[model samples]
Target chain A: MSREHQKYRAPDALDHTRELLGKLAREVSVSDWHLVIEVRPDDLPEVALRLRDDETLSCKYISCIIGVDYVDWMEALYLLRSQEHAIPVRLRVRLDRERPEIPSVTYIWSGANWHEREAYDFFGIRFIGHPDLRRILTREDYDTHPMKKDAWPHRVRRTEWRWEDIERPKRLPGETDRRDRS
Target chain B: MSTVESKNDAVNPGSPVNQDGPAKPSFHLEEMILNMGPQHPSTHGVLRLVLHLDGELVVSVEPVLGYLHRGFEKLAESRTYLQYMAMISRLDYLSGFFMEWGYVRSIEALMGVRAPKRAEYIRVIIGELNRIMSHHVAIGDFMLNLGAVTPFFWVFRDREDAMDLVEMVTGQRMMYNYLRVGGVRWDLPDEFEAGCRKFIKEFPAKIDEYEELISDNEIFISRTLGMGIIKPYEALDYGISGPNARASGIDWDLRREVGYSVYPEFDFDVPLGQHGDCFDRYKCRIEEMRQSVRIIEQALDSICGGPVNIKLPPMIRPPAGEAYRAVETPRGEFGVYIVSNGGLRPWRLKLRDPTFSAISMIPKLTAGNKIADLVAIVGSLDLLMGGVDR
Candidate 1:
C-alpha cells in the first residue's frame, strides 16, 4: 500500500469495536479486514442495536443480509457499514439445522425487514419477529426455500453432483423422501 | 355485499372508513382498493402496488414483488466463478459495468489479485460512461412520469452516443461482459479514448440543455420541490444508498467514502441535496452526470500503457473465504457477497441491490400522498426491478 494514496482510518478499528461490543459477541475476529462478530441467536437484536447506537462504531447502513445452508448447520450473515469509519462490520449467527431461526433486527434497522424476509423466503431461516415475514422474491406458495443445499434436484446431491451414485437425493427437512423430482 | 359495497370495501379497518357498509355515495365511506400494475405504464417494470385509497388520497401501499424473479441467487450455486461473471451484468442492465466491476473486484480480492493500471483506467472510463447512461434513463423516466415527453426523447438521443463508445470497446450495447477476473477481456480499443474525449467535451453542453429544458420550469418545480421527502435519519434507517441517500443530505458516497478502485486518483466532487425531496433526487442525478464527465476527463489524461490482463488458468478456484465488495452504481451501492468453500462454485452468492432497499421503504414513504404524487414519488425514486428481483 502506498503512503499518500491511502485514506486515514482508525489503526485498531477491530479493537475499538471489540471493546464497545463487550460481552455481547461470543467471538470477534477479522475476515478480509472486516470485523466479524459471532453472537448467539438471542443476542442478535441487542448486538445490532449497540452497533447502530454506539459512537465510534456507528454502523448505520445495512448493506445486506445473507443466509447459507451447510447441511449440518445454517448461517445468517448481516453486513453493515458506518459512513464515518468506512469499515464493514459483519454479524454471524449460526442456527440449528432442523429449525434455523433468530431474533429479528427490523426494529433496530428498518431496512433489515426486507432482508430478513428474503432470508426467510430463500433459506427457511425464521426471523422470529419480522412484521411481515413472507416471501419477498419467490411466489408466496413456492413449496421450498430454493437456496438450501438439499433444495437441489432429487437426482443431484449437495457437495458432489454425482447423480449416478445415489439412489435418492437428499430431501429438505419436513419433506417426504419420495423421489418425485423429475 | 352489492357491487358498490364490494368496490368500496375497507382496505384498512381503522382508517376513518366504515367497515360495516358503504354509507354514502356523496363521498364513499369505505376505503377503495386500487391495484396498480403488474402492467401499469408508469411502473418501470412489472411492479405491482396495492394502494389502499380513500378517494384520491392513499391510505397505505403494499408493493407486491417477484413478478420478474428469475432466481439469480439460486442459480449462482451451480455456476463456476468464470461462468457467473456473464450473469452479473444482467442484475442491473442499465449499470451493467458496475455490476461486472463489483463481481470481479470480490473474486480478485478472494484470489489476492489486482487488474493492471491500464485495466483499472479502462474500467473507470466504461463505468462512468455507464453511469451517465443510467442517469439519462432516470431523468428521462422521471420527466415522463411527470407528463413531460420532450426530455425522454432528448435523453434517448444523447444516450445513443455513450452507448456507441461502450459498444466500440465491449462489443455489446447492453450486456457488455467485458470485465474479466484478473483484469479485463482486452485493452482499450485505439479509437475508444479519442471517441470518449470527444463525448466528454460535448457532454457538459448537453447537460446544460437538459437543465434549460426542465430545471426552472414551473410545472417541474411545483410537482417535485417538496414531494416525497426522505429525512436524513430515515435514509440511514431504511438502508438507502447512492444518489437516493445522498439526495437526502446523508453526505455518504461509497466512491468517496470507501475510495475503492482508482476513484481516489481522480479529482471530483459528490453533489448533495438539501430538502431530500423528489427535486433533490432528480437534481442529484443531473449533478452526478457532470461529476462523471469530470472523472472521465481525468482518467483519460492519466491513463498509462501496460498489459491489460494477467493470464490465469481458465478454471479458477479462489481459496475458501467470504468477501463483500460494493461499487457505487447510479442507483446506489450495488454489492456482491461471496462465500466459497474451496470449491468450483460459490457456496453462497448474495447480490445486495440498492433498489431493494429503495423498494422496501416505499410503503413508508408513499402513505398519505395523493395518487398523482404517488406516481411522481415512485418515478423520482428511479425504481429498477431487474436488480431488485435478482
Candidate 2:
C-alpha cells in the first residue's frame, strides 16, 4: 500500500530471507513481498545461483544489471525478475574499488556478458568468471575508463581533411600493385 | 589513372585487408579477415565488420563499433536536465524521436512524475508516427540488403511524406528532440494535425503499393522467407524484444505488457509470427506500421483540449532513487535505467538498448546463412549502432 512497498512489488519477486541468512547470515526482509539481498562480493555468485534455480525465486529474466562507484566502494546491482510471479528481486553486492573482482553472472544471464563488459569497460570492475572479457563500446586500445572521475578528457583530433584526400587509387594493367604503382 | 597513382603513392600499407596476402592468419579458422568498412557505403554508417571468411561463406563475424560513440551518456552527466534531453535524439539517429521520448520518460519516471494526460496522448501519437517512419527505413534497408534498390526508393518516397509531417510538428525532420522533461517542447500547430491525418489516410494504400512492388515478388519471398531463422525460445533466451521477438512468435510488447502511457486506450492488435525468420520480422514491422496508423487515428480524435506538459520546475533534481522504464520502440524494447542521487544530473544512466541485444543474436542468426543473406539478416534486425556502441 505504501510507496516503499510498491517499489518492490512488480508481480513475481522472491523474498529470500531465511535462505539468504543461512548462507551469509545477513539481515534480509520482504519489502513488498520482494527479496532484497544485501550481501558482500564473495557471496554474490552463490546467492545469484540460489535465486536463479530455486522455483520460488526463479529469477529467469535478468532485467537490469548496473554498477555504482562510491570512490572507495563500488556496488554491482542485479535486478532479476520472475516471469511466473512477475516480481523483481534487487541483489546488491558491495566491493572495494582497490580489488574490484567478483564472480561473473554470465552463466546465469548470457545478457550479463555485455553488461559486465560495459561495467568493466567503464568502472574497471573485473568479473573473474566471465568467459570473454574484451573492451566493448570502446577501442580495444583505448586505456582510461572514461566513466571514472579521474579520467582525462577523451582525445580530440581536429582535422580539415577533404573527401578528395581519401579516394581509392585505381589500377593499371601489369601493375606491381595498384597502390605500389600509384 | 593519375588519380589512382596519386592516391596509392600517398598511402602506406593502410589498406589492412588489401595489403595482407592470403597467408596472414586472422583469429579463427583458415579464413581470411576482411575489414568491411569504416568507409564503405553499404555499411549504413562507419561500421567495420571483421569478417572471418572461408571464401564467400562467412566463418564468423566480429563487428567493431564506436566509430560513432560520441560519448552520449557521459555528455548527459555534465549538462543540465533540460539540455541533456536534447542529445538523446541523436543516439539512434534513425529512430530519433523514440530515443528522445524514451530518455525523457525514464527521467520523468525516476522523478516520480507523469506528463499531463494530453501530453501522454500526444506522445503516443508522435511516437507511433515515428515508429512507422523508422520501420519504413528499416524495411527499405532490408530490401536493399537483399539487392533490391527499387523498393528502397519506393519506401523512402512514402517515408519522405511522413518526415514532412514530422517536420511541421517539430521543425527538424530527422533528429527532432521535441520531447522535454515534463512535456513536449511544443504543441501541435493546426496544420500539424491536418498533415498527419492526410499522411495516415494515404499511408495504407502506399503500403499496399509497396507490397505490390516487392513484398509478393517471387524473388523477394524466396530470398527472405526461409533465410536466417531463430526460434522463439532462442529469441527470448537472447533477450530479443520488439519486432525480433514478435517475429519469433513471442507476444511480448512493452506497450501492451507495461501500459506506459495512453497506449491502453488505443485499440490495436499485436501481430505475431509463427516462424522467426527475416521474412516474418519484415512482415511484423510492416504490420506494426499499419497498427501505428490506427493508433494515430484514435489519438487524433482525442486530441481535444488540455495542457501538453505537467507542472514541474524548469530544473529537475529527482529524489535519490532509480527506475527502469522500457518502451516498445520500432526496433525492440528500448529501456532506460536512470539513477538519481537527488542531483540535477543523473548519477547513472544506462540503456537496455534493443540493438545491443539484437546485434548479439547476429552470430546465432547468421551461423549457416550465406554471404548474400548476411545483409538481409543484418538489416532485418534494424540496429541503431549509436544505441549499440553507446
Best by lDDT: 1
TM-score of each: 0.91, 0.84
Worst 10 residues of 1 chain A by lDDT: A2-11
Summarize candidate 2's per-residue lDDT along B352-384 as a digit string, tens digits. Answer: 788877777677677555677787788778876
| Interface RMSD, model 1, angstroms | 2.4
Best candidate, TM-score: 1
Instruction: Provide the lowest-lDDT 10-residue window in model 1 chain B.
Output: B6-15
**Which parts of model 2 are misplaced by more than 4 Å?**
A1-37, A54-58, A83-85, A153-182, B1-29
lDDT of every model, 2 decimals:
0.88, 0.76
lDDT of 1 by residue, A88-180 (tens): 788999999898989999999999999999999999999888888999889978899899987757836465856577676567888874454
- Could you tell me the TM-score of chain A in candidate 1? 0.80
Reference-based lDDT, residue A13, model 1: 72
Following a full C-alpha superposition, what root-mean-square deviation does model 1 have from the true structure? 7.2
Fraction of the native A-B contacts that model 2 recovers: 0.28
Deviation of model 2 at A41, angstroms? 3.0
Docking quality (DockQ) for each candidate: 0.44, 0.20
